[model samples]
Target: MRVSRLSVVVAAVVSAVVVVVGSEGAAVAGAGGAAAGGGGHEVDLAFHGDVTLRAGVVRVRFVPRNHGPSDLADATVRLRWSLPLVGVRRLPVGCLRSGGGGVLCRTGALEAGSLGEPVEIAARVAGRPAEVRVRIGTEWSGGAVDRNPRNNEQSVLALDTGDVYYF
Candidate 1:
């Protein structure tokens, strides 16, 4: 059998395409030999916080940390409470009220291996419940891809006994 150069090149191209397609969701290393997403900079933001509910009032204190090799221009964090909000007493500088039981906050440009500004929010929930479930997650990360999302999302159950519950 005789082989042509054009045929060989075409075969190689098809093989490359197939390989790339097959590894779509697989853990493949990037161009720089790092196991990031699509060879782009990875930004991982982990949130640590504590919440206390007392006398129908809820207080939250949290800090975000970047654990990746890249810096993000900005990031958004979302907090949701199980009960509806009756009133907002205080919110961080870049934080805003969202809906009835949610708050969204923006963390200005965060560098890798650095901690963002501490956030504090105080609000009142409608009626009095024995406990409230608070969920924290990353809303946005400057369009960067995060490989590990488990650390960025957290959930906590805070009782009205005024004890701080850490997430």
Candidate 2:
């Protein structure tokens, strides 16, 4: 059989289209070129409840949802708390890994424990701050310990409640 110029062009176009379609669902690589997941998988984390520090014990909690294909690991939580009446001060909460199917964190404490009330609590991950109001109350009595020694900085999300709150 003889092939015409028009037939050749059509064949080429069809081949190109097939290649493009086949590669449409290609997997995306993560930090270390690891096959992260499909194009539609995503991870979403959010803070739902209030964090309360009482009786020398600090309690912190959150809700983390894995909307992505791969699980998140070693996610760091940065916390900054200050009182409106008092001057600005930065409280360091350290980095913590994820647990319980990428849901919560129970990291250590940034400050020992205080008998005062913190006016504001700001929690951040991947440099983005959470949209909820972090409530700090010292109903407990625990000594404040500095965890961040490199820059004399403590982990941004440390509380007696847990090592690292994942959600």
Candidate 3:
């Protein structure tokens, strides 16, 4: 059977409409899946270091914040010093040696959009070592996804017994 010109035109228009509608539906479905996967569980970390220097001594308070839609559990913090500071001690977080003048501590659950309790670390200047620098960051935990990993680490110059701070 020979097809008429009008019938051919109608068929082409209907085909085009079906293809466009199908594509839109697929796009919507994919967006819905992504939203469900996120589930307000995206977590991000931000680090803040407070350094105190006085009389050949240094103290660092490492505060990490969870900028998240949900709370985080068992997050870890790491602190590293440039100098081989003597008399180093970690209070309350049970941090252990991480080699090369570094310490690590595990935090309890961090509330959503909250700053964690500061981890206190102090050390004595070892016979006029080089300028003190402290670097602090968060360690990854299982099943928790951090949306912004770049802000998880921070470094600061210790403000104690140095030309920068004291005379």
Candidate 4:
């Protein structure tokens, strides 16, 4: 009886160990299977810093990240500035390449003929739009100019043709 009980105890302990090990292996296998299946990749889009207007030129930067599974393509950025009576003008869209760090975009003069203070600025990825109010000014402090009076600076801006993003 004693020998039988000892054998039973040993068998029970071994069975428990085998079950635990088997379950852990199965869990790992399940995780691997899930990973093998198609999972959507996550991408992060960040603005490097605030938009700066100096000497009539507007400088903007964007940072895009491909978390993995896929790469971002055909990314386009549109800049719009609000004018008093003339309405909103769609500035040329610039194509940016992803460097080791991020994507960068710089805009030409706020105005073609002269530098006009911009009331608002926006960035769009693909066809989506994200806009922000921008403080436009020159290096020389003539005075604070309010370009957007009615606060209707929120405007839909478009990019010029032939401008697009490449992964």
TM-score of each: 0.78, 0.25, 0.64, 0.24
Least accurate 10 contiguous residues by lDDT in model 3: 158-167
lDDT of 2 by residue, 48-132 (tens): 3335433223334432222223333322333333212121123324322223111123232222121112223323322222322
Residue pairs whose backbone atoms clash in candidate 1: none
Tell me the lDDT of candidate 2. Answer: 0.31
lDDT of 3: 0.69
Clashes of each: 0, 32, 1, 0
* Better candidate number, 3 or 4, judged by TM-score: 3
**Mind giving the per-residue lDDT tens digits that candidate 3 earns over 1-167?**
99999999999999999999999876655544435663334577777666766766677766778887667776777877776657775456557767757778876777778987767777775665445777777765535667687787777775445433311
- Shift in Å, residue 130, candidate 2: 22
Candidate 4's residue-wise lDDT over 1-167, tens digit each? 25688898999999999999999977655554425442222222212223533322233433322222233232223333332112212433453333221232332222212222222233333222232223222121112122322221122222332232211
- Could you give the candidate ranking by lDDT, starting with the highest? 1, 3, 4, 2
Give a tens-digit lDDT track for model 1, residues 27-119: 333432234434356888899989999988889889999987787779999999999989998687899988989999998888999999999
Task: Highest TM-score: give the candidate number.
Answer: 1
Which residue pairs does candidate 3 place in steric collision?
Answer: 53-160
The residue ranges of model 4 lying beyond 4 angstroms of the native Cα positions read 1-42, 67-69, 83-167
- TM-score, candidate number 1: 0.78
CA lDDT of 16 in candidate 1? 94
lDDT of 1 at 146: 84
Model 3 vs. true fold: TM: 0.64
Taking all chains together, the TM-score of candidate 4 against the true structure is 0.24
